[model samples]
Target chain A: MEPLLSCENVSFSYENTAVIKNLSFHVNSGDYLCIVGENGSGKSTLTKGLLGLKAPAEGKIIRGSDLHGNEIGYLPQQNPAQKDFPASVFEVVLSGRLNSRRFRPFYSKEDKKIARENLKKLGIEDLIKRSYRDLSGGQQQRVLLARALCAGSKLLFLDEPVTGLDPIVTEEMYKLILELNRKEKITIIMVSHDIKASVLYATHILHLNFDKSFFGRTEDYIKSPMGKYFFSE
Target chain B: MFNFAEMFQYSFMLRALIGGILISLCAALLGVSLVLKRYSMIGDGLSHVGFGALAIGSAANFSPLEFSIPIVILSAFFLLRISENSKIKGDAAIALISTSALAIGITAASLSGVNTDIDNYLFGSILSLSRSDLVICIIVFIVVMILFILFYNKIFAVTFDESFAKANGTRVGIYNMLIALLTALTIVIGMKLMGTLLISSLIIFPAIISMRICRRFKTVIIMSSIVSVVGFFAGLVISYNRSTPAGASVVLVNLAMLIVFYVIGTVSDKIKAKKFLKQ
Candidate 1:
């Protein structure tokens, strides 16, 4: 079967300066791909390109025939505006079904069922009626994860899911993500700065560097020169 | 002494009451989204542009409402476009556009020599509402309410998170423009009742005040609508009895409600905190 997502010699630029250059990779179905890079390695720009938020200045990105554009779930980094936003957990999660509803004004019965199931999956069913802003950081992340699941069951893009979380909460979050990838069989493309956790959980690792990039299985990546240096560091 | 039965005796008073309540309801409905999106001042900015458009329309011998609607709508779109792509930023762009429009409106009104009472436009006179104006107000109110109901979910999504909405193929640009368009219509029609200086209060105050006590988006919107209608009606009554400017009275009523809700919100928050500690 063809890969779920493939990018061929993709490049992105901002204000005439190239941020991501000649990047090429493919993600297979049911694969957990961790994109590990340092600050300003164009991780965000690459994610934007893959998500179709920005057009690649060069090359092309192809999505598999079975995958629709709106079926990709995305959990963006938390912004300040949402910190004080007044919304119930149900309303925020229900909004994830906006794509499926299309021109329809309201969510259908099936949409509501899915939202509720996702909330249960994330162990946040009790928070359905709670105010979103009042939740702790860990609880908030779970709510957002459930929301992303409602949007797309096949693929998920999580940007630094454990940032700003305590060590215990971060471990729990990682375990939850691992369960989704291994048991639920969901494809995940997570961007992270934590190389250790990425190596521990990801099936495939894509190490982005300005001069040279590496992409391969987790075992091969462990032995690779760039991986050895970063892993040891 | 204010007579409760005597206030509704005048035909102009009834017209003002109907027009004011409809505009207030529409403004409050759109206000929740606008305030959440941090575009609350868009109403104020667009009303200034409407005032300018009305000045030009009168000078050119055209129906002010017909001519101002399209002009103000175009300005609304322009404001959205520039704020998105330009370096001026949202608040600065609004200030630039609104001030320039106000200056142009004042100049046009002075040069045309058309016996136009500029103060009527500046402060709003409820007694000036005519039967024809009330008819247009009713039509615009229906259109605003229908569109809002049809796109309520989408608006909430866009306001809460533009990037997430766009990623899921929600067409954020179109919804943003839709909001600007509806607000332009509301501001132009409301300008006659609330004046350019005070119309935005009708769009902003009720939303913020209701948010003090309402925790959910639906409840916030519902509460704001109720607050707006009641506040506008009370303001109209006070203005009728005291012979005060309708627009100022309406704003003061809203401001007073804001304080009342603020106290209520604070006290309830303390009570919740105490209960949590006990648990």
Candidate 2:
């Protein structure tokens, strides 16, 4: 089967300044690909490229025809601007279905069912009528994850999803992501600042830095020199 | 003491009430998204642009809405683009455009010597709404209402998170332009009732007031509509009774409603906190 996503020699930039240079990767169906990098390491930019929010300066990004734009789910990092965002959990999740339908004034019953199902999957079904901002950080992440699931179950891209989460919540979020990958067989591309956590959950690892990077199976990544340096000390 | 039935008998008063209600409803509906997106000031800026366009139209002896609607829409699009592409962002860009348009409008009004009409545009004279203005107000209201309903979810998505909406294949730019155009038209029509100086209150005060008491997007929108219509109606009545400026009275009514809602929100929070503590 063709890969779900493939980026061949892709270079990305902002304002003519290159952030990602000649990066290449492919994601098969059900693959849990974790992108590990330091701050400002182009992880978010790479995902933005794949999402078509930003066009690559060089090379090609191939998303399967069935998996373009609104067909791919995304969970961006938390921000203060959305702190007081006035939305019910139901409304937030239902918006994810906007990409699936065309020219409809409101959501269909099928969309509502899908939203409800995703909320249940994330164990947030009870929050459907609750205010999104009233929830705790973990609940908000779950709500967002449910929304992403509503967009597309075939692929998910999460950018530092647990950045501001507590350790226990982080572990739970990772478990939830793992469940989606393992049980639902969803493809995941997660940008993570925690190398150890990436090694723990990822089947494939793509390490990015200013100058050089590594891309391979998690086992090989663990034994690699840079990985040795990271894991040993 | 005001006689509501007697006030309704006057044709001008009827026009003012109808036009004011329609304008308020439209502005309130669109206000939720604008407030959420931090583009509330865009309404203020675009209204200033409308003032300039109106001045030119009055001086040129043309229909003001014809000139102002398109011009304000263009300026709104320009503001959106500048904020997106240029280093000068949100509030700063609005202030720059707003002051420039205000200055140009005032200067043009002075040169043209159309002082009375300009004053009507500046501070509003609801009692002076022409039949044509009423007709235009109704048509604009219908268009805005229909477009807002059809694209409600899309607008909600865009307002909540533009990047996420884009990633999800919603054309962020097109929807943004749609919002700008709708808001611009609403502002143009609304300037007649609230004037250029105070019209943004029509687009802003309701959202803030509703947000005080409502937590959900749809609830906030619904509440805002109620607040805006009621406030506009009450303000019209007050202005008619006291012979005050319709625009200023409407703004004051809205401000009063905001205070009421703020108190309600505070009280509710206190009660909830007490309940939680008892538990």
Query: What TM-scores result for chain A when each predicted structure is judged separately against the true chain A?
Result: 0.97, 0.96
**Model-by-model DockQ, in order:** 0.85, 0.81
List the RMSD of every prediction in angstroms: 1.9, 1.7
Point to the candidate with the largest DockQ: 1
Residue pairs in candidate 1 whose N, alpha carbon or C atoms collide under 3 angstroms = none
Best by lDDT: 1
Measured with DockQ on alpha carbons, how good is candidate 2?
Answer: 0.81
Q: lDDT tens string, model 1, B162-252? A: 8888889888999999989988988988988888888899999999999899989999999999999999999998887788889999999
> Can you give the TM-score per candidate against the true fold?
0.95, 0.96
- Model 1, span A76-171: residue lDDT tens: 888777877889999999999989997789899999999999999988999999998799999988988998999998999998999999999999
Name the runs in model 1 displaced over 4 angstroms: B114-116
